[model samples]
Target: MSAPKIKCPTCTRVIEYSDQYPHRPFCSERCKLIDLGEWASEKHKIEGNSIYDDLLSDDLEQPD
Candidate 1:
């Protein structure tokens, strides 16, 4: 009998199922935690210019 192999999402490393991988998708626990922390801190954000920034002009002056 043989186990299946999987790829690590962080480094794209080929890992064997029998390696007792605690982190399934990642090759190591460190990589897994790094990815987890990224999500926790809201680091994964949508790429694009902010609409609010465009709507608000810095050059606009208020009447005294």
Candidate 2:
């Protein structure tokens, strides 16, 4: 059997999904870092409220 192929999430570069590619889903460190930057900068976000949202609201509502 051959290694499975996948596209890098950042650049959409087709790559082999195997140990040879350390950044399997990304193709290179650059692409991996780019994706990380997007998340760190809030460019990418999961669609839904975070659990901490309720906790933070509760904290704000309490008298200090």
Candidate 3:
């Protein structure tokens, strides 16, 4: 089992799997940093929701 070379999510730099390299999937630290920045800044938005809860609301009111 071994990691494969893939483009950096931020800079699209090809990264190979090896011991000589520390940050895999990224060409250099800068690329990794950029990716981190994207994550921190929330440039990507994933869509999903919990399947357990289907109810919109459960509010009950009584006249006083």
Best candidate (score: TM-score): 2
All candidates' TM-scores? 0.54, 0.80, 0.57
- Per residue, candidate 3 scores C-alpha lDDT tens digits across 1-64 of 6767777666776766776567776777887888788878988656665344434333435457
lDDT of 1 at 22: 72
Which residue pairs come into collision in candidate 1? none
Off by over 4 Å in 3: 1-4, 50-64
Best of the two (2, 3) by TM-score: 2
User: In candidate 3, which residue pairs get closer than 3 Å at backbone N, Cα or C atoms, i.e. clash?
Assistant: none
Best-to-worst ranking by TM-score: 2, 3, 1
Q: Candidate 1 at 31: error in angstroms?
A: 0.7
Per-model C-alpha RMSD: 7.2, 3.5, 6.0
**lDDT score at residue 12, model 2, on the 0-100 scale:** 96
Candidate 1 lDDT: 0.80
lDDT of 1 by residue, 1-64 (tens): 7778888877889887775887786889988988888888988777886888766867657568
Candidates 2 and 3 compared by lDDT, better number: 2
The alpha-carbon deviation from the true structure for residue 47 of candidate 2, after best TM-score superposition, in angstroms, is 1.1
